[model samples]
Target: MQIYNEFELIARLTHGLTTRPDVALGVGDDCALLDIGSDSQLLATCDSQVEGVHFTLRTSTPEQIGRKALAVNLSDIAAMGGVPRFALISLVIPPRFSQEALEGIYRGLRQEAERHQVAIVGGNIAGAGQGKQLMLDITLLGTVRRGQAITRGGAQIGDVLCVTGSLGDSAAGLFTLLHPDGTGAENALTFVQARHRTPVPRVAEGRVLSAFGPAVVTAMLDISDGLSGDLQHLCERSGVGARVFAEHLPLTEEMQAIAARVGKDPLDWALHGGEDYELLFTLRPEKAREVIEAVQAQTGTRITRIGEIIPSGMCLIAPSGTEQPLQVRSWDHLH
Candidate 1:
């Protein structure tokens, strides 16, 4: 076998690939360039799905894998309150999977692409060695009206911290899948499967946030990492802080029951479990109701106020009145 270096191969292909008009220089050079509307902003996001690290061959169908690969990137765009317009997918498929499976992956990709209305521009594909694992790396390109895209650094003091849907259901569901011995496997597994396999990107909610006006809704982020980790990111980015009320946390019933069965802390998972794909944003005191209503009407996504921003840095206050300095969770890559 010819053992070509990875970077060498990438350079060769990057320089040689054919390109379209929108792709200013395609690949190669220091960076890839593209043309954009005079009044629009370019929104870009990247997501990498590994064979075993992110999914297992035994549990995941290739179709699910492909859809999820793109879904995550779409979630990023949604977090930024941007509208996705196109996508490019890179593939590293091993020989073990039949051609049918590979085609299935593409089928899933197309389905999701159509649903999101994102065009499949083009991408590179490579065949992995017999012993190597398959991988999918996706990059989604999106656009938003000029000055309309949101960022993590917009939250202000006294803003409300709101989230979409119940928390820890995904974590509880994961527990049920991994440990069927848990009594509530029936209750929790379904939610976990949906969370893991096909996370719903909050695109509509994001746009609604923009429409509600930036003065009302300042900071915005998606919970790809756990709530605690992501909230911390938003705070740091905005130079603000948060105080969460445990009693106010909108955790599902399944989460509480399953947490007890598995002897896990429901609060911890609610704070720290990753892959929930929910949006967490800070809204002004006056705009909270209007923002929530507007987003609900426009996107059918529920919004709940779990906490509020404070000058006291990030702190978590339990329902039982237990107060503690909120230490950072370990789910983040930064810490």
Candidate 2:
């Protein structure tokens, strides 16, 4: 059998793929050129998924892995309330990896790209030595109307803190897969596993929040690195403090059940559980209800007011009305 070179692989994957008008130059170039036009500001972000670190083939399929690698980057664009337009995907392949698996990864990537109107413009692939792990990296480009992109630093002291959809499902999903012992119900197992395998980016909801003009969303970020840790990022950037109401956290019934069965705190999953991909944002105190109603009516995505941005440091407010300092217990590269 004749082995394919990098150019051949690129042609096979990108052939017959759709292209956007703004993408002036695409694959087969040293660098992709994009014509962003006069009305939109560019948005760029990158995320990586590794074989052992992010996933194992034992638990996830090649398609799921590819879809997730792209989804996470889309979540970043969504956090800024932008529309994704193009992507550049990079891969580090083990020598023994099959072309079938490569096809599956591109299939998954195409699935997500088609959904979000994003085009896969360019990327690179490389081979690795024995025992080296597989890795997938994605660099996504997006755009937002000029003077409209939201950031983590704009939150005000009295803004109401909110999150879209439920939290902790992703963490519960990962835990159920990693530790099957004491896990109850096959249906519940599937629910959580599907969540971990295919997390949805809140692209529509983010656009809704951002479309109400600049003042609607005070600050925004996607919860890829756990709510507690990412919230601290927003707080630190805004030079503010925050208080989360523990009781108000939105936890799914399945997540709560799984936590109870495993003797784990659902709040912990909701607070420190990473990879949720839900939007964590703040709105002016008086406009909170109005915006929440509009979001629910338009997107059908649940929005919860879990807390408020304060003046100095972050904490979690217990149901008993006691306040405790919130810690960064989410994933960190180094201890």
- Give the residue spans of candidate 2 off by over 4 A: 1-37
Give Cα distance to truth, residue 96, candidate 1, Å: 2.7
Worst 10 residues of 2 by lDDT: 24-33
After TM-score superposition, the amount by which residue 277's alpha carbon in candidate 1 deviates from its true location, in angstroms, is 0.8
Query: 1-335, model 2: which lDDT tens digit per residue?
Result: 66565445667889988988876445532123356777776777777888888988878888988888899989988887788889999999998888998899899999989989999999999887775688899999888776667777789989999999999999999998889788757887788788899899999888888786558688888898799988987887688999999999999889989999999999999999999999999999888889899999999999999999899999989999998998878866433
Instruction: Give lDDT tens digits, candidate 1, residues 1-335.
Output: 55554434656666756767665324321113345856766777677787776776566677887787778888878876778888888988788867887788899899889888999999999988774677888888887666666678788888989998777766666666566664566646666666677777777777778665567778787887788878877887688889998888778776787788778998888888777888889989987998888888877777889989986587889778987877766353322
TM-score of candidate 2 against the unseen true structure: 0.88
After TM-score superposition, the amount by which residue 161's alpha carbon in candidate 1 deviates from its true location, in angstroms, is 0.8
What lDDT score is found at residue 42 in candidate 1?
72
Write down the lDDT of every candidate, Cα atoms only: 0.76, 0.85
Error of 2 at 10 (Å): 32
